[model samples]
Target: MTKAGIIYVVGTPIGNLGDFPPRAQTVLAGVDLVLAEDTRHSRKLLDHFQLHPKLQTLHEHNERELAPRLISRLQAGESMALISDAGMPLVSDPGYILLHAAREAQVPVRVVPGPSAALAALAASGLPTDRFCFEGFLPPKPGARRDRLQALAAEQRTQIYFESPRRILDTLQDLADCFGLARPASLSRELTKIHEDTLRGSVGEILARLRDDPDSCRGEMVLVLGGAPAPRDGPELAPVLLPLLAALPLSQAVAVAVQITGLPRKQVYAEALRIKED
Candidate 1:
């Protein structure tokens, strides 16, 4: 039986080549094959580092078909690396199928971590990063996009999204409409490149700036939106507390009720006991 080979899910720079780690360079250079979302685009990165490796396309359209063949190659003991055009693979990018297949086959997979546009934007955005969610790209069609935004209107965690230059303005308009004009947001574009710029303001203000300066809309974009504010009034407790107390142990029920109601644990525990007594 032939020993299987390893798959390295490498991360490339989003913009500045300087952000590419040395470990990523070594892995890419040593790998027998490099699976790229775009062979043409990835070739430039390889050439910049003076490294030559076999490049193959593994993008959205062909990933499902290509994954099985690639897995066979790995089983045959050929080491491979997977990379997107920028950032990590499988982040609003392709490669999930291949990675999932590799895992099922028990092939060893490793990550050569590096820059991510979403992380870079969020870090620089000065928003609450303690608890956040990446929403990737919103729906492209107007109605679908608006519907999606409407669904996320109540999301409490800071949200990150990737947007294209062509759709930035329109997306901002919809974000303002759905999330409210005064909601805080940060728009970071052309990150890590010389012309990198991050505009932080209310959704409406950022929308106004983009309209005033069309050039800002160019290049890769990441939008970070503040979460919904906590409700001012606490919800009435009995309806929330009674069911939990009945179904769960007193302590467990109180803990869950606290999470759901955003009320003090002590208060929830007291209410739990009172309801039990009643």
Candidate 2:
């Protein structure tokens, strides 16, 4: 009787090949197969480390149909490593389905930590990292993107998102409008690469810089927005909320007025109290 092989979740560099973890090489060389978001992209890493395996492309498109095939190999005592085009796998990338199937088949699973663009950018951002959230990407439509930012307004924790070079300005504009034009932000690009740069400033300032000198940014980018740390409880809206409460019932106007500012009633109530006093 033979034991089933394990599936290793390997993390790779987003840009600089030098960031590749030494353990990633060892695991890949030991695996019988490699599941990658893009075989060609993974090839560059493989060449750099002088390690190779039977690489297979398993992205969003073919995940449903191809997962079974990979599982069959796993049952055959073949261990495999799953990697994304950049950073960690299934983080704004694919391979979740395969991972799910692997577990269902009782195959062993292990992770080899590597570089992450989200962490790389967030750290270089010089923004709040004690607590953060990864938004991935906003909707492509300008209106939708703006709506999304408005939704996340007052999130409190720093927000990190991925965006294409072409859409950087637009996304920045939306965040500026929703989070406030003067909201501090950082635009990090080619992190770990020779041209790695984390341009930091208010949203408006960064937007202006990127617009004036487009060449300053290339490749992928991570946008970090400083969020007000989540209020321990909720916001104390009593001040601003008090005035409205005096004019109308607390329950009726609490939601309506807070809608525009995107603050909780507790926060608005605290503001309401201040409004009533003055």
Candidate 3:
């Protein structure tokens, strides 16, 4: 009996076709059938390499219904490949259903890494790359987005995000409020394309740049926002902190004062001591 087929999760180019890896092309041509997130989008890619595998649509809306059938084909020893509109199959895209099903059925699975928008943006931003995080997209709803931003207000790692072109300005405004206007950031758009641009500055500067051009925004944007400022020297404690401590318990008041005034814990504790005695 022939061995069960393996599922190759391939990553395609985000912008430039030149980003395609030769091994991915070879696998694309060799697969028994190619499952695409969108046939029309996949057509452009297949056309580039003259690959015409048996095509099937496997997007979010229809993935569950079609997963069992696709797995059965794989079980019967037909190797397959999956590709998304851009980038890898499952980074904020569909393919998870098929992947989970494959594991249950004991089929082999593999990856073919390629251009990732999050990585592309981060590498080009010139920000501190040693530590970073990828936040694919915030909640679409206004209230939820704000709540999330507030929760991340004190996060100290460089934050990376992928945003739709239309939401760029609004997201910038939100970031400015949460991260402060002078917070450094980079907005890279039309990446790897001829007219690609990366705007690097404080959040306010990016907002102004987008506002001035009006017509400049036309593609997805990768927003790399700087993280929270590191702890600075403690604020002077006596005048600002003592009065608040008067009504509160020693321990609770000092803790609250540390947060508000950025005062050192020891210094705040001492002020609380002096005030308690008075």
* Top-scoring candidate (TM-score): 1
lDDT of 3 at 107: 87
User: In model 2, which regions exceed 4 Å deviation?
Assistant: 1-4, 229-278
lDDT at position 11, candidate 2: 91
- Per-candidate Cα RMSD to the true structure, in Å, reads 9.8, 5.6, 6.1
Tens digit of per-residue lDDT, candidate 2, span 1-278: 11248889999887878788777888888888899878998898798789878898888999999988888888888888999988899899998898999889887889888889999888888888998999998899998887777678768889999999888888876765555456678999988888888899977789889889979657788899888435433244444455566778755555545544444335544555555566
Q: What lDDT tens digits, residue by residue, belong to model 3 across residues 63-146?
A: 999999989988998999989889877888899999999999998998889888889999989888999988888888778887
| Residue pairs in collision within model 1 | none
The Cα local distance difference test for each model comes to: 0.86, 0.79, 0.81
The 10-residue segment with the lowest total lDDT in model 1: 258-267
Q: Which ten contiguous residues of candidate 3 have the minimum total lDDT?
A: 258-267
Give the lDDT of residue 162 in candidate 1: 96
Report the Cα lDDT for residue 164, model 3.
Answer: 83
How does candidate 2 score on lDDT? 0.79
After superposition of all CA atoms, the RMSD between model 2 and the true structure is 5.6
Off by over 4 Å in 1: 1-4, 234-278
Ranked candidates, highest TM-score first: 1, 3, 2
